[model samples]
Target chain A: MSTPIFANFHPDFYVERLWDKCIKCKRCIRECTYGVHIWDEKKKTLKEDHTKCVGCHRCSAMCPTNALIIRRHPSDFREHALWTPWFIKNIYKQADQGGVLLTSTGCALPYKNYFDHLVIDACQVTNPPIDPLREPMELRTFIGPKPEAVEVEEVNGRFRLKKKLPPVIRIEVPIMFAGMSYGAISLHVHQGLARAARDLGTLYNTGEGGLHASLYEYGANTIVQCASGRFGLHIDYLNAGVAIEIKIGQGAKPGIGGHLPGEKVTEEISKTRMIPVGSDALSPAPHHDIYSIEDLRGLIFALKEATEYKKLVFVKIAAVHNVAAIASGIVRAGADAVVIDGLKGGTGASPTMFRDNIGIPIELAISAVDKRLREEGIRHRTSIIASGGIRCSADVVKAIALGADAVYIGTAALIACGCTMCQRCHTGKCPWGIATNNPELMKRLPPEVAYEKIYNLVKGWAHEIKEMLGAMGINSIESLKGNRDKLRAVGLTREEMEILEVKHAGE
Target chain B: MPLELEVTPFHYSQVNKIIREHISKGEREFVLRGVNGHRYLFAGVSAEVSAVIYGTPGLDLGAFMRGPVIRVFGSVQDGAGNTMDHGKIIVHGMAGDVIGYAMRGGKIHIFGDVGYRVGIHMKAYMDKVPVIIIGGKAGDFLGEYMAGGIIILLGMNTIYPERPIAGLFLGTGMHGGAIYIRGKVRENQLGLGLKPYALDSDDEKLLESYLKEYCDDFGLDISEILKEDFIKIIPYTHRPYGKLYAY
Candidate 1:
């Protein structure tokens, strides 16, 4: 027999019963982006290379015959009890050492005690919930520029600028779609977001991934991203949006390069991006030119110059331990807004290890950053947008109450558009066809339908947010931001409570 | 008449103003020589023309191009082919960074090494196949989430002692077409999501035709170029990203 290349092999592991159910249809092999399965016609059997599996579950999900039953590799630790303990011990060592976990994409860490760690409070007897039907609740708030400081300037018996700032450029709601590039998802997804944001009177982000020509009509409601890649970036691209966001880092792949592999680089995507086909589109891990706060200002000014300062410039950073320091720097950099993505933010694809590890939680990260900025007295200078695991309205309320001007929705947006949280987005075989770049699959999702869903989701969230605010006796979102006095820590230690800057209820 | 716009002191003003007017007037062919790190050289040129840039051109060269042929005699900087469509782009020297971001169509040839994410989200249309060829080493994610078209990485002679010098995450989420990496690469070193095999005779012939055309363009000896073995990465099926999710 030929030597088995793979280290671990078991003959008994292969179920003979599965062969009887095999219909000879190659759907699993065909659908699997990783090419893990091969049909051996001569043997009347399907050969699966377990090593090649990225655990996307696309194969089992796509199987028409129900022949393929993919389960977690069955553990035999009890049979080989001696080696199992060492094996388990080594994994802890790896975790303690802070070494690379070598995962594929998105967070795969075992869900920690999130509910216990974070807590929200509501005034029970004193604050009566305002009726959302009769009473007017304000979720409306501008995301762009504010006055440099709380000062009124008089120029020759008149204000310096003739145009009065349109009372916080009122949006009907607080929820907005987070930055997911056109390349990472599909044009249909972009159109869906654009249409949805427009309908909802909110905004959708065209991530550092370039904007397709088709979605140009929804520019008024769009937040065009200008990341290190600079794809689809031009005077027109800059000017053709409500806001321009400079993407510094992503929560999923923090401190890593923004890489869109060549295979996903299709003609339409390439045209939108203005890059060549089948060439890796690399966004540098670090903005090499931006060495200091002064350098960041130079970039900000350059963008301002290019766009004639009409568009709002936002500096986006992954919420790290040092986010407070970074946010302060961004404020000094003269940015109108700051967007912070927490560790749980989603990606089309990222190293599994990086996604699970390497960043601070949104709850912890936000409170710390908010406190840091406020302490530095720069909190009001720039607007704050927080992302990562804002799955529902409660999270959004908690986030805004914790000092965020607004919240950016990522995983939730996907969920609204029929994303099944399969976590197989890195492989371009998203069955709902939302995340992959595959032309055939992307066509499955009509832009119109997808857009409507996003619109509905955001609208639903907005209504819920208004309700939450009414219950808290607050009418406006702005009044709720950084109002952590309304919230309290549940199971946190004294130090943790201090760090979160919240007291226990009834304290 | 072939016009020469020589870049001096890293200032692209003299050349840019003229090219802007020339492109506005719909001039087809222009040559820019001695471009030594001049930034934003030919950005947002929406003409169906060709400009051959000699020497290194700095950041965002040929950004948002619409049916324009841009050939770099030497290297170019960040955002080389950012959102370009319907033209040919050739880089003789190594490209600095972020070669083709979300490009739709057109052919880009890199004679030397290329920086990361060569074709991030490169899509294709019916008959409008976008082709990219890299002569030297490529950075990570060679063709990330590519919906269609062809991406060829010819790992030519490298100064680095590493035998198989290719990028990480090669052909990740590649649904359609092929990625040809020259030379045998170790499994771990290649760092691709997909495992590819050696090219068949028919595919080798197709690659040879392109290689021949590349040789003619850059004046390379065809025999010498074909000396190295080529590995062809084909998705097991045309629809690698088969319907895997549902509402």
Candidate 2:
């Protein structure tokens, strides 16, 4: 018999026997959102590339065989007396000092530069741009119920009240707070958000964490969330809101439960959640009551009945592979608005793997959802809110141009309110106490300062947005959304170019 | 006013939803009949409101009830009287699983068998302690992680069958509550995550009032039901598992 043509067809990187606790159950392979783990049948073992692991730990939870454990990869380098290990040590010091672990995109490690590689052009000649300082800048936008049709009539003795049938209301700016539950962040953070929203003429979200009795007075400016756990949910919570948000999934940790470990369920937290003290709060990934689009409609109507149809309903979903299809489904599900979070979103404490590798980019996801809704002739039926990695004013402008009626800010809001993103939120050891439930740590987030910072951030962004709009010769934000004809894709693949539907520059 | 109504499959009646929302604050007396397979009946109603279910009800019947009285004429679906504050829910027929989940105040009376998680996470406020009286056998996790209040399981069936009275994980994380399971509970079948003990005279007396209420609601002989033995379960402390990390 002829020898095998290629005997050394083995994977280059393989798990050593030391980590043999792994029973080759393929649980890791199945649960990994990053597509990192592979099965080597010949060796009857699992092959994992350290480079591919994002450290989400979703695999650890599903390992029924109790064979797999999750941990950070150990790195070994040649012992050098020079400035070696300085970079790594400095990174550690930054974390220890409660400083920002500044990162780009979803993952921290350098991959491919996409956003920075592209540039936006400004018109100097031909287009007579209005100066932001001396011209009328428009940021006014509406989000809720709009009339199906309009009718105008004149009366003999008095003018008619031209019944504008639209149920949708308008917002002065295209900005709002995203979902960040009470258990995920601190009460002070929520208070800060509430105050900032009221001050900035915007809306703040309660996330699925359930409303604390303390924050009930901010009802008009607040948006209560109904999530899987149904934590702290009651009649008062339902009625105390301007809008109700049904969270299907999060951009950072989609298709997974938001686990509030038992360690953080303090007395106050337990009271707020209505669960007994010292028990873990588990927010299921899916709403057990809702199974399909039609079921979602039932819930929407149920909320309407409970709240007497006084509040609008918004559906928040993660940006996933078929987000366009999902968005279309949500529109048909009878939601007044849809909020999509890109994979690059932030979470108080998500498995590192899911946070870094799962889901699609916000720009692509927003553009696709928008195009699908428009193509289906339902674009005007529901408002779209895009989130995830919206860092600066320019990104917000880009998101709006891509087709989002508004944007929800999460990580950026925390940053404005003294969050350094030390990545220790899971430990609840936040030095700034912005994400901790500990009484002492929580006290660090005073409502006064946090509110001021958020107000300043929103004001600065609002100003910049107007400047960008005026420079682009756009009169209003409504005129900018989904107007991709004014945008161009730079260095994108053919498929991406088609998906974004933006032409090549100068094409 | 005592109202008599009948519900068929096509009747499409949601008495629980309508009466609960429309009932003005402080209004009490109510009698409802003909409630067959209706879901979310009397959900989210506050205390002081009293109603009676004449027939079998759908899922989540009388959930989040406070300061009210709800008597089920027939077997109740899953999650009966969940998250109630204060009131009494008497089940003439068997009750579905997860009965009285997260109940704070008031009492529950079940003449027939009950499913799992009975009185789970039950608590008590100042001057208000919740109570649950089960007539037949109970499923697992009876009073699991109970924070406060009292639970009385009166196995009124005399002919002492071989089947276990309560299931596993009884009072698993019980902190500051009392659970009473009466009659003969086999030693080997006591199961894990619980500490069982005999009921005291004080405990029996505490259950006596709830037993009388149960008998009155279903028109059963209170003396016969009280003749049997009773076991009481009390959660160890208020913070059973200590402070959790997640708020």
Candidate 3:
């Protein structure tokens, strides 16, 4: 309602109804939640307001007669190199209403993505590649600390493990769904993620939100988070998850706290997050207790103590500068795993500046952290989970090759669940029902449907990852870890290639 | 009969393992002797059990504990009841910082002084209110970012008469809940945007209900603790930082 005329004049998307192919049905009006479509009785035709559309393409996909065309508005303006449309329009928005420029999902910037420049190597005639169809190619990954040494003893002519191993989260695929709180998305998405994780033998993080009562049944596949807000955290919620993750910061908005606006804090969200109905869930910027690495150690052990040391405990931080050193300290602080989220990490809502410009890319961070830990003789002590901007199966394979134990996908997971990345999540009126809490919009994404989509997505990606592994002549995913020799960079600077730990294409 | 477990010789893990083992075996009452800095004394004991600790216990003494009544005879360390869902923790002596950090339900009654940031981010829901009643003086940054619950600081009969009842930055960044100081509090001692108000009937009732149990926990007279008029400190807005940023 507070949208200024300057923003309204330039539509972000152009929604057109093909008159010749139009069936004159009212399906567009019903499908759109942004009030973009209206049926005129006099002309027996439909009209649309392109400015109201967020480019979700829901109507285009659902159009019965395929009469809808949605694209970026072709409106032209004299281009200024520095002040682009978004910059100029954002200035207008702030001048009129003075609210933080907010957005959802990953950063939309065109920063140098190392994944695009780096290519995975394939086996030539000299090395025979294993066919995934015939040979057993292991993709199984265990996320936790490994013992310093394994002591085996002979038992009735059979070798047996002599000591009890630490707890671990076992996953068949190296890809996982990143943390998206129940309040940020709909309950349907959380249920879907949980069911998918259960069905895929993987894990889905619950973000900082406490576990919903209905989701406790899928505890074996869930990773409950403890953040600064400490919301909805109790013994039951901690025990309900397979692992506990201390959410120090997120990739999208590093160093800042999360604010689930009061409007989106519905009754069920209030119940799940353990706050009063209609109250904003403000997670504090810092865990007040964790002021130093020792303090972090205290909380890490505290969680371990709470769970009686049965569940693995992980620490997640954004891929900021000096991330490698930060990760080293975290490992020394006794975390079983470290989750590094890059600048391209997605969020339900984040200040645009922080989302785009705050953190480094996951590619560099994972390489740096893995190399540092290995140099420090502690790489085997913990696992590194890289995330942010993981697009397809190739990206997943590259991340693992760069020394990540696995990767977490937030935006990619949502895209599979029908998100078009329209950047309207902060408005809390998501037309695709992927980022809204409204009951009607949430109904569009049933739990079963979301589960099916995400399940197929991961399943398909897993097969593709196997194909990549087969081409690389690697029999197991673990054998590919930290194997930067299998990667080559094209058109990257020497310094960038050094940071990425990949060689030039010819070399 | 309470089972006696001397936890001085074994590691915290072994001590805690034996303690939880008895708990799962339906042992409701426990007596931990010589508990010299043994951490996680009753961690994750969800059943309705009770423990009597003799010596000083280490960090997170009862973290994530549910429905357990704990009575510590000696002073306790930081994170005494960290994130405990239900039950009571009664410390006969004093407590360290973050004694009840982020605890959602149950009550913590410390008989003596407490360290800084004692009740940081403590929360409450519906009828399940988390309460922390400190008998002596408190340190700085008390109740910082506390969302919901009640923190009653009774600065009566403190050892350090030279110091104020509470240090600087009291109730800093508090968005919910009320802090009842059993005496006058200067505005300078409170955090920015926090105001002190006179107690209303509901505040009086809430204080009375918790103080009755508090007085019994420490064997103190309820009338003596309530003799002084109390002032309350609360955030004016639930969202203190709501209007901070531009869209």
Top of the candidates by TM-score: 3
Which digits, one per residue and each the tens of the lDDT, describe model 3 over residues A1-507? 754467778887898778898887888999998899998899877898887888889999999999999988999668889889988878877776677787778888999898999999999999988899899999999999998899999999999999988877899999988988888988899999999999999999998877778899999999998888888788888888889999999999999887787667788877766666666788878887788999899889888877888788989999999999999999999999999999899998888899989999999999999999999999989999999999999999999999999999988889889998888776678888888889999999999999999999999999998888999999899999999999999999999989888999999
Best by lDDT: 3
lDDT head-to-head 1 vs 3, winner:
3
DockQ score of each predicted structure, in the order shown: 0.06, 0.08, 0.54
True contacts kept of 1: 0.04
TM-score of chain B of each: 0.85, 0.84, 0.97
Ranking by TM-score: 3, 2, 1
| lDDT tens readout by residue for model 1, A1-507 | 964432233211222227677786888767765557887889876788764554545566667767777655664446564566434533553544443332233465555433345556555788777867799888887776565445567898886764566223345677888888888888888888888888888888998777788888988898899886566665677778888888888888899757665557777776666545655555657654355787577557545544444677889888787988888888889888888888888887665567888687777777787888788877767788888878788888888877788888978888777776766665556767888788878876788889878888877888888887887788777888888887876767797677677888668
User: Best candidate per DockQ, number?
Assistant: 3
- Residue B57 alpha-carbon offset, candidate 3, angstroms: 1.6
- Score every model by TM-score: 0.64, 0.72, 0.95
Candidate 3 lDDT over residue span B123-157, tens digit each: 77788788999988999989987888889999874
Summarize candidate 2's per-residue lDDT along A171-198 as a digit string, tens digits: 6778898888887788888988888888
lDDT for each residue of candidate 2 in B1-247, tens digit (9 for 90 to 100):
5444444533323454456444764346666666777766666555466677778876666665556787777888777776666678888888877788767677888887888777766665446677887887788878765656788776663223555788777777666667777665554444333456787787767677777777787788978876767665554444442332111
The C-alpha stretches of model 2 lying farther than 4 A from their native spots are A1-127, A151-170, A276-278, A285-299, A328-331, A375-381, B2-22, B25-27, B32-43, B53-68, B72-212, B221-247
TM-score of 2: 0.72
The deviation in Å at residue A386 for candidate 2 is 2.6
